[model samples]
Target: MKVTSHRDEIRVSRLLGASRYRVEKPFLSEGVIYGFFGATLGLLISFLLSLYFQGPLNRFFDPVKFIESDPFFYLSVAALEIIGGILVGYFSSWLSVRRFIKF
Candidate 1:
């Protein structure tokens, strides 16, 4: 039942008039922003790599040019990944901070 430094900081913030929402919001928002940035970067790198390797891939597989021919499929997948990233980030941050803020 000993209060750790992390809990102390949360308690101090509450005592100093910061609302629970105010304290938790930043963590959630930061998680979301980071998730979005990470997902976008990952998607960009993957797309570029696929483009760069298209010739080798086509030569090896003979019918693997979906990247340029069916771009909407890739776009949909990218959208889903970004959305999933944002959701995971928000939930993880919320879960992590929920125990620290007593109120």
Candidate 2:
């Protein structure tokens, strides 16, 4: 899918005399950027939802309350999310590019 989307750009770059590394770098960087932003957005949404659940809504569900998460726990979870995103993005891009642009 990645290869299909970037096929034209990759071919154009090749035609324009771009070296393999030069052509690949931008795609890899793009993937990393996407992953970073995605993870950050996910974290933000989850945090917001947690806040909402912890508010007056707790009165309705008194028995099943939201646990107050520690700042450190949040930080650790965020770190893990970002790292996982980076790794997934890098590997996926690398695989797609490698398959499409065999050197």
Candidate 3:
């Protein structure tokens, strides 16, 4: 009985005309671009969904109107919008990188 090494086996298989496939390297730029695009799309989708929900949400909590009428309303809304945008951007970017990156 003879023991065959892994390399030897591969060589023998190739010699016997076995079909083999080569793996290609992934491009960094392509992945980066894809992630950027996906993140943008995700953010837009999230914003739209938020808007749709906000209509009903405001009705349920009319206090929002009162809050809006307050002097600080503008500042508060601005802060919220900024925070929401950052959150959406980060979440979308993360998902895109994790799900679409070949690496």
Candidate 4:
């Protein structure tokens, strides 16, 4: 049995095709993943809120004001939220792996 040490990050990085990509790919991918999560989270919250409020607050859930007025509005909001989440993930990845790469 071959045992790999945690310090073998370099070897692992190279095995991933290249050292730079090892961190770059994860950072970018993590961002996209988190962004999708954020977008879904926003939509889910909106849905739940719509269901929770039945009286005057129900107006807040009107498709005329929120969903129908502009389809692009929802897309943009989701995109923005996704970007935000991705940025955070990217920053976190950078911070975590910055020290691991030597060249």
Best by TM-score: 1
Candidate 1 lDDT by residue in tens digits, 1-103: 1123457776778899998897788778978997898889989999899999988878998865454558788789999999988998888777777755557
Q: Identify the runs in model 3 with alpha carbons over 4 angstroms from their true place.
A: 1-26, 64-103
Between the candidate structures 3 and 4, which one is better when assessed by lDDT?
Answer: 4
Q: RMSD in angstroms, all models?
A: 3.9, 3.0, 13.1, 6.4
| Candidate 1 local lDDT, residue 63 | 67
Clashing pairs for model 1 are none
lDDT of 4 by residue, 1-103 (tens): 0112333755676787775765457555766587678767877898688677755665665655544368788689777777787777666656655555555
Scanning candidate 2 in windows of ten residues, the lowest lDDT window is 58-67
In candidate 3, what are the lDDT values of residues 1-103, reduced to their tens digit? Answer: 0112234654565577664421111223344455556555666777689889987887898765452377487467655655565565555545544443332
Whichever of 2 and 4 has more TM-score, that candidate is 2
Error of 3 at 88 (Å): 14
Pairs with steric clashes in candidate 3: none
Worst 10 residues of 1 by lDDT: 1-10
Q: TM-scores of the models, in the given order?
A: 0.78, 0.74, 0.38, 0.53
- Model 3 alpha-carbon miss at residue 44, Å: 0.9
Best model per lDDT: 2
* Model 4 lDDT at residue 37: 84
lDDT of each: 0.79, 0.85, 0.51, 0.63
**Candidate numbers, best TM-score first, in rank order:** 1, 2, 4, 3
